[model samples]
Target: MALYRGTGSGRLSRGLLLLLWVTLGSKLCPTGAIVQGANTSLAVPQNWTAHESATPDNKSQLPQFTLDDHYWLFAHFCWINFTIWMNNVTGAQLCDWRIISRPYSYLQYCLESAAEKLKFGYPNRIADDYIFKSHYIYFLNCTQDHPVLLDPPEDMLLALIIAPICLIPFLVTLVVCKSKDGKTQS
Candidate 1:
């Protein structure tokens, strides 16, 4: 039986092939693999101001962050990253944990504060008890202007997804040509 026939049938075949390719492609190349060197930076948009600056003097007074809080934030970050990758969103999104510098050190400061509060194996009291959680939320809400840079492993995995899509045309051509050759031989 012939695979592709008239133009209408050929279109239908291509569409079905595309659908199959996507389905198989996703199964073959899953996302969120957590490959190392998937480094991305978070950028604070202009006109956005942090509620308070974390300074050396106040480092001893920041509230503590619980294990659950850390876990929740980690999950949130993963979900956001997954969404960005899945949607292939253009431009950068917020990734506060990736920010390691001062002035915009939302995540770094929060973690340092958490560590400080846990000194001597005991949680310390602070002026604002909810400081850690608040800052965590704030950083989560920050925006990233730069795109996520995928490392070699991640690049190859992503290429696996695209390579098949790109080969669709060549694959269909090969199939059609084979059918034509068979007909001629017959």
Candidate 2:
């Protein structure tokens, strides 16, 4: 389909084309700042898993998550792009987009707060295998912030159910072929 019609002489058409190009083109072009931010070191604190296994006496020292503003922006862009890419590939919205601009500390606080809620407030609402790996989770270093109130279907159960359905036709065909061979030979 033609984006510009006729001789493309109209100011309105030119303005519209320019606007569209700017809006769509910016996403394709990443800035050097974001690239530099991507290289920022994320050193995991010593005994980082202490939060998971700490006793009440030693529960005060939880690992701190720190990221510069530029890195945080990179994370945000990565997350948004990932969601968009996945939605396009799946032809459906597999995950919701998070597009709020905030500091990395705020993001950490939000994830930690949610983790506390999932741990204590509504434990049943947390999904099983909720800590599965993903780019958003890894880049944010928020593995403990598992999906809440989102109980996805069981992968193993689905695979088990589909396996037999897939094998039955092939097995039946093999058995019928063997029977036909036996009868013909006899």
Please, what is the TM-score per model?
0.20, 0.17
Off by more than 4 A, model 2: 1-67, 91-186
Candidate 1: residue pairs that collide: none
Worst 10 residues of 2 by lDDT: 122-131
Report lDDT per candidate: 0.39, 0.37
- Model 2 C-alpha lDDT per residue in residues 126-154, reported as the tens digit of each score: 21112122334333433344656664569
Q: Using lDDT as the measure, which candidate wins?
A: 1
lDDT of 1 by residue, 44-80 (tens): 1122222244344775423344554343333333323
| Model 2 TM-score, 2 decimals | 0.17
* Model 1 TM: 0.20
lDDT of 1: 0.39
Report the lDDT of model 2 for residue 186.
Answer: 39
